[model samples]
Target: MTRHDPALSTPAQSALDALRANVAVPFERARAMPKAVYTSPEFAEAEARHIFAAEWLCAGRADALPNPGDYLTMQIAGEPVIILRDREGVLRGMSNVCRHRMSTLLEGRGNVRSIVCPYHAWTYNLDGSLRGAPAMARNEGFCKDDVTLPTVRVADWLGWIMVTLNPDAPNPADQLAGVERLVGHLPMRDYREVFREEFRWNTNWKVLAENFMESYHLPVCHAGTIGGASDLNQMECPEGEAAFNYHWIIKNDLVPLALAHPSNTVLQGDDRRITWLLAIYPALLVTLTPGYFWYLCLTPDGPGAVNVLFGGGMSADWCADPKADQHFAAVKALLDDVNVEDKGCVERVWKGLCAGMSGPGSLSHLERPNYDFARYIAGRMP
Candidate 1:
């Protein structure tokens, strides 16, 4: 089988071939991925087809839609999708486009009794079945029961709502069993989501994803907020698993809330201050700690833009504290500051990647997760 597709533009094929070559060597000798992989439109399109469309992507947490009518909308590889809970208390994924005339049915996140189209009054039940259509009685061929919205695949794995355009994709929970074994004692599903925000950054999605995969840049890029607390010599970057990659660093006293709460008996000794950074396959990036957790779900808007779903919250132990509100306020402030620093760093890298003289560089030992991520990407390319 050929690594490059014949239909791909010459530049895209060449870029993908370079990426494959970059990951062919052992991790200790691996170099950085070629610059073209982040700047090629054709290559991004190929990723949309083979990776985003074929794999399960995180859609925030299931707790976001607690009621039957609560729903949220997002685009998966350019296809608008709705994640909602039906009256039967079942979570579902469905087309967000109206069945009548293809107009979008919902916007952002909110609770609705039913999905009503603004264009022509087409209504749909929470389960995505066509409820009613105005002035359609005269159309002899129009059957309401036969005009329901199409269903998409959705699943709740460890409190995260995961969706996929491909029906043949493996179950996320089954594929991520390794992750469960690592963090299962923490009760990840019980963590409450305190805040969720949407953002668009001036950088490639892969750039941001790779940034989250490795902590090598934390000491420099996030110097103002989190850098001083992270010790490069203590960062752990083990070989990545098939479904995800992770690294851990012990928390310092910089932010007291980052450590385990006094009431958190689950994490003892050094585990109390350990912070885990996890990159779940294609797009979910998470930072899990003993007291709080935050995550980003990434999707590419184009070669130069990335759409992000950013959210975080405290663990049940911290939330039950008498000063829970104060603790969370401090955590949120720190996260916002860290994001500002990251935005500046990644965007600058993108600007450099666009330069004519820019190209691949050598990988650091701390970048083991990045090399694994490159291998995953190359494995999915045409």
Candidate 2:
């Protein structure tokens, strides 16, 4: 006989473990994944494989690597990769690790006409081709071609740069081909990360993703900001399109397009009744409105620590204004409230489990949005 945990009941735990193997389903209509999925080290390792390794994850902006020789380096899904504008002005990527002695090639982002391994000084072109191997050649049959800084596959879509651990991985667009058509019409090229900051929050990255999937906290966490600026009572799930339970928060006069379902805050204003957020799989939250975007934390730096990255997606007016600073500050305050609400809940959950409080948590019958996220992750698992 098995001792059953309600939160980890056969049904809930089974479904959640399913997500550990696959993707999630919508909650309520589907089933919530188990708490262990969020807290387990094994689950994190699996995610690095099935999800991040296989999927097309966002690295940064194409504009960030504007000029030839300019490069940006980051670790994604545990791969130390570098993105660079080649000497030919082409965007490219290479393993940051040196092919020779395993020391990192580039220490940081800068304009380097060529990439060189700091160790033993093995050099490579901006294109990731080896240029020189200082002393290894005379020591052994060290051919540069076989030892070029192991380049990863790269593709630039719109203005975003994407890198894959797979050497011959299919294009990110192919994986997201469905997404492009679903929410493609919005002009995203003009928008930029106007505000950016990342901090370590002790919680699973999925908690950050889950927190952004619904507006349940608006009435409490951000009542002052969202309640006053937008309506919380009139929010509903958009009909027709199959939402994976992850979507963007739309605000008043602030929304620039016609959304399938209008959140109450926007219903009070004209031209602001609709905005759409494309919740790209594996934890990318983007709010696409005219001028700029409001965003949620990606939390991709391992599942334990969520790194908040968002800010202005300004339209022409916001970009050209002298008050851009004020606008950013306002966004920060508003986001701060939402973060406080979410962080409080997530931290409590983490602490509870640490204190052995793994009990079944309630899901609001009305919180369909949160359910969607639960389902999505559940489906992703096995």
Candidate 3:
């Protein structure tokens, strides 16, 4: 008879055991993960500590902080962070907690000459050094120069800003090496930021990441917009690399914006006809088409919720066209409609997971990206 150990039987442990079982199955016969992995608070906490906190997470577009004093504040794995361009035009990341009372020093994005604590009015320079303390003069041996905001590692890759709370985490640029060779033909570096928006969804962060990584649902979920343009059978998910998972689908028809622009001779043959979607494990989801690219940076709010930062922009060549504005408006409308459809679908999936009426379901052959995603998560969990 097999013996069960009570020492390894917490809710998080059970969830991880189930997850390992699910991912252990062969790819051709794999089953979906247990709903507990998505609905258990204990499991979520484990992921927050083991995956999100230790991974290099996408924060936002570098263009958003174009000026030296520009800054954006966000929370990563429940830890508040500030990403900013300093006085010398260098980008930096640091804890947003005030050095004095530990209150949050920043709230949203804007240009700030200095970070001032709202609680007790402690001020910090753009580089995170203490500038002034309103009432610390009374304390003996107090050295303002010794105080500074805790610095977080930051990297700018392909126009996106990525931050890591783990000081020892590998730079995103290093992990994403050769990515430029894959999509370098697309004028990404020159693509200007159009707009950025955030959406709160009632679904696990993994669900959203998996949803974006595969093209299986495009024909049904995104039927009205990008669906008809893609051939579901033609979608191909190749073996994923250690850093990310990606798939490609040939478009039946060029998107309106792409059709309007002159062919980017740099992109040969099928490159002009294919769309690639990549998920940088744990959070960043990117979609690259012939004429433009967009991304979602997924962050878990808890076990059953996610906050997504959605943004995109036109290729520099396309943006140079005289009718670019009208074309972009059309693209934006289609994306908005698609997002609405996805929100409903994922939320319904979450509801189903919560109901507990279903067991692990078989995956479609096209869900290879998701299979890899499961393996990635399983490998990370304790």
Candidate 4:
């Protein structure tokens, strides 16, 4: 699709060009992406089109909609999307816009017998087929059977609901196969989502994603909570793949939450003491610890803003413990504190980009994730 935003003028194009050039450099020689990439509306538009629109993005947990007709609606890649469990217990995704007048069909989350448009009441079945349309009998050529909500591709990968607007987008399950084996010890299917929150940050989406993918800033940015127990030197960042990137950090002490439950004998050696942070390219950020798992689904609002849905859960084994309630409260508090720290740091970074006083900075050996992330962005851009 062609983007005609005035923001795509000469200066924005120049900045994007520079960023693409910088990303092409070898990781050892590469500097950070140009500030414009985080401050330019044109570049953000490009990303929405090339990356978000074309990729399979994690929306939320499939378990959230356990029964048939349960549905959730959200905007993905700037388009409204509806995810629902059909009568056959199959998960489906479709455009939320009513085909008649283009009005949105649903809001938030709920169980609905049929998707009835608020404006004209153009009704659709749970499977997205046109069911009823008021006052259409007089229209000679109108055929309800010929109309249906446009289907968006949908997949459930390890219990997470993933959707894609691109008709030909690769299957998320195929791309994320490695993740299953990586965290197979955790009962991902049984880990119910116990908490969820949405936050809007005045920073580029990439800034938040890269921030979560690396451990280099933990000692300084998250000094009060997790940082206190972390040793940056102990981090192990493996080379990133085309679909995802990950790193592991060993905890100095056993996490209290993990200790409250029996250890999964399936975990070997230092795996019990390790925390893994993974980024599924484009926007999904996942953290897997022995005690719990959390994910942040990032969506770019524009060059200077992002919308985030953060959700997490305790492992099935941990949730079965007698002290699960107390432990959950503590874990939630820790997550809240970490969120505050990350917000402050990324907002400051956005301000730095706005100042326009400095160019891209060199990447630290510890920031390999950022290096790979930059290249991923560059590869998606024009």
Q: Which segments of candidate 3 are over 4 A away from where they belong?
A: 1-9, 258-260
Clashing residue pairs in candidate 4 (N, C-alpha, C atoms within 3 angstroms): none
Q: Lowest summed-lDDT stretch of 10 residues in model 3?
A: 1-10
Candidate number with greatest TM-score: 1
lDDT against the true structure, per candidate, is 0.91, 0.60, 0.84, 0.84
- TM-scores, all models, native as reference: 0.98, 0.79, 0.95, 0.94
Cα lDDT tens digits, model 2, 102-155, are 887775568897886666877888777888876564766767777667777788
For residues 99-151, write the lDDT of model 1, one tens digit per residue. Answer: 77789989999998999999998999988888999999999999999988899
- lDDT for each residue of candidate 3 in 1-382, tens digit (9 for 90 to 100): 2223353438878887888888877899987778888998988988888899999998878898999989998898899999999989899999999977799988888899999999999999999999999878889989999999999999988888988898888887788875676777765667777879998999999888888987888889987777888787777888787779888877755466643246466777787767778888789998877777788998898988999999988887788888888888888888899999999989988888889576668988888888899889988765
Off by more than 4 A, model 2: 1-31, 167-170, 177-185, 239-250, 253-273, 296-303, 308-312, 321-326, 336-341, 353-355, 365-369
lDDT for residue 63 in candidate 2, whole number 0-100? 65
- Per-residue lDDT of 251-273 in model 4, one digit per residue for the tens? 76635764325646766677766
Candidate 1 — which residues are off by over 4 angstroms? none
Comparing 1 with 4 on TM-score, the higher-scoring candidate is 1
- Cα deviation at 185, candidate 2, in Å, is 4.5
Which has the higher lDDT value, candidate number 2 or candidate number 3?
A: 3
Error of 1 at 157 (Å): 0.7
Record all residue pairs in model 3 with backbone atoms less than 3 Å apart, i.e. clashing. Answer: none
lDDT of 1: 0.91
Which predicted model would earn the best lDDT? 1
Cα-based RMSD of the predictions, in order?
A: 1.1, 6.0, 2.3, 3.0
